[model samples]
Target: MGRWVLVAVAPAELVLIALLAAGVEVPAGVRATLGLLMIAVLLVEAGRWSRGYRRGRRRGLGRRAAATVAAAELVPPPVTTALRWEARVWTGLVRGLGRRPDIPPGAAAFTHHRAMRAVRWTFVGVLVVEVAAVHLLVPAGALRVTLLLVGLYSLVWVVGYVLGAGPVRPHLVTADRVVLRCGLTTRIEVPLAALADARPVRRSRDRTASRQLAGRTLHLVDNGGTSLDLDLRSAVTVPLPRGRSAEVDALRVWVDDAQAMARQVRAAAGIGPGAPAELPPGR
Candidate 1:
């Protein structure tokens, strides 16, 4: 906890130092934005604390979600394991029947873990609330119809986002390439030769890379998605799981094991520590 506190404070401290050195006052807009964000967080927490939150417009959806989660917990571990087995079988059946484009079936096994479930469910939950708001708040007739249409678009967006960028879906890593399966539409791969390195990061490194890359990085820091950053051989355009393709200099992905993954990838790609680029501890 102490280390985490230091990590959290480091960035703010750096900003303050830089501003002081430069003899510049903080911008009014920046201060206002920060203040507003703090207030928003406080209000959200207050709402969460109140019993009224449970009885809000999203109450029905909340109850259903809670029930489902509770029922899952009530099942014995062995029973849950058996159910997961069934789920895998069904998943395989669906994959076979759906006839989507996929990577070659070879030495590359399905090492991809399911993306964070909490984040996915939260996205769905927010969309449900938006849909409810559209129906209740918007006046009926053309405007309501239009707003409901907007709500439908939001549904599609949430589904696509959950399927693509948000969740850590199945990924395939082999001696030849790394295949990332993003929902139904995207199957992104980088040749082994193109992968410079793979490094696992905790909060500190995650923040470091995010700061270095800025807009280039794709991750869910607060909500907790995987943050295994991969440096590519060159800048390339890759499709985002949820939206349009963007040319990125590097890629950040979630993997189950960072050390083993980095080792295998380096061995496969024939990269060595002799290279000028310094990789953090695992690399």
Candidate 2:
């Protein structure tokens, strides 16, 4: 946190110092724009943190089971185990059959690809600043390429939108025991047993019941020193899960089964849920 604070503050401080040292009057509009931009980013981040992804949240019965187990310390380990099994099976069934896009665990994995709108707006801002700045700094015809840049930027957004909804092609490769598959460059792969720890986070969003539905996230780690914090909801987006509803359910079941197996393997390997081994202790 301290490092991040310094990182953010240092750049602005240096930029301000340089401008003042050079005797260039700092423009009010630039300062205001930068301040507003930082505020907007901070607000968006706060909103996301408050409304976490929902893939990690267990289903209704699973939630009950968790509560039940948590409420009573008198409950034996065997009872707890049974509750976990039941919850896992029930949640697996629901997730498989819901036909929703499975989200990947990492925050970056989920938001980066899907945020083309934000990127588009950013490009627009850049183009506006560039054109304005160029017009002021250079004589006519020197900024002749502004129109070309505008067209190119416009084309980028159109192409991104078209591809964003279309069928995605995955490029898969193997790196040692891990398989790497890229869907918009999101990768997920690790040996079945090498997964040393797993942690699940539940999120939901509801508006009418004064509730909000959030998504789930699973943080994972492997013994081979690979780790990923993924949101399952983000990972599962696309092509409506081919075939009939049953097929979709089957896919979901398969995914849940894989999750459970990975969790079990982590437990057996003495890995806890949540933090991956490779990550630093306080993260």
Candidate 3:
């Protein structure tokens, strides 16, 4: 749990207790209305996210690829799990302090969808402005406006969560060459001879805490694009080996074994070394 939430709990509890002492009551109808509102908000947001994901898939996703992406979108952030674990540890620590400590709720990872994060934040800023205006200039009707703002925030918040949970599928295929299909827009082939190296890119929230990270990475100029243009994070790279056999290594072993067979065919036909080999054309 965050420090801010923990600190607020004490005052929030005290405020509730004071309200009870003063005979303040919240109507049951209002509680039911809020519950229904939240349910509606979640369903609408989920629908919108599903629609966008489907459109991406329908344009060209493979069956297995579509399923993989769908599943990622469905799960909540893993940080939420970490926050729950944090709560259990803190509970035990505070138990030894003599005071009866109330336990704090765990934190959950909430993600903003890749494309929607900007729009969501902008909506939040607008809500903040509306809230400020209501409180400062129209205080008499602020209660209703505040409730309306809360409902709108809840709707947008669920949209952000759905985007965070949406599916992501990246392709890595190993054949005679390496083939990578990204999103619906790119198709890449890397000849093994031109491949220079493969290593994992290490990622950490704080750089100093971890020394080593591992994942697949490949380095090759490819038919086009720089090494930086490819998704190297969680990717692998293979560099061409050096020696007298380098050219043959790229043509026969790296590009395709069929190229070697075609070379043999050309030699048998009394063709010179300068002849174009009957190898499959590059895409």
TM-score of each model, in listed order: 0.40, 0.22, 0.21
List candidate 3 stretches off by more than 4 Å: 1-27, 67-208, 212-283
Q: Give the per-residue lDDT of model 1 (tens digit) for 21-68.
A: 556688777756655655555454444434333444255547656555
88-112 per-residue lDDT for model 3 (tens digits): 4444234423333221233111111
Backbone clashes in candidate 3 total 23
* Candidate number with the higher TM-score (1 or 2): 1
Best lDDT goes to which candidate? 1
Top TM-score prediction, candidate number: 1
Of the two candidates 2 and 3, the one with more favorable TM-score, higher being better, is 2
Whichever of 1 and 3 has more lDDT, that candidate is: 1
**Poorest 10 consecutive residues by lDDT, candidate 3:** 243-252
Candidate 2 Cα outliers beyond 4 Å, as residue runs? 1-120, 128-143, 146-188, 201-283
The TM-score that candidate 2 achieves is 0.22
Candidate 1 C-alpha RMSD relative to the actual structure: 23.6
The list of candidate 1 runs beyond 4 A from truth reads 1-103, 107-116, 166-170, 179-190, 193-253, 263-283
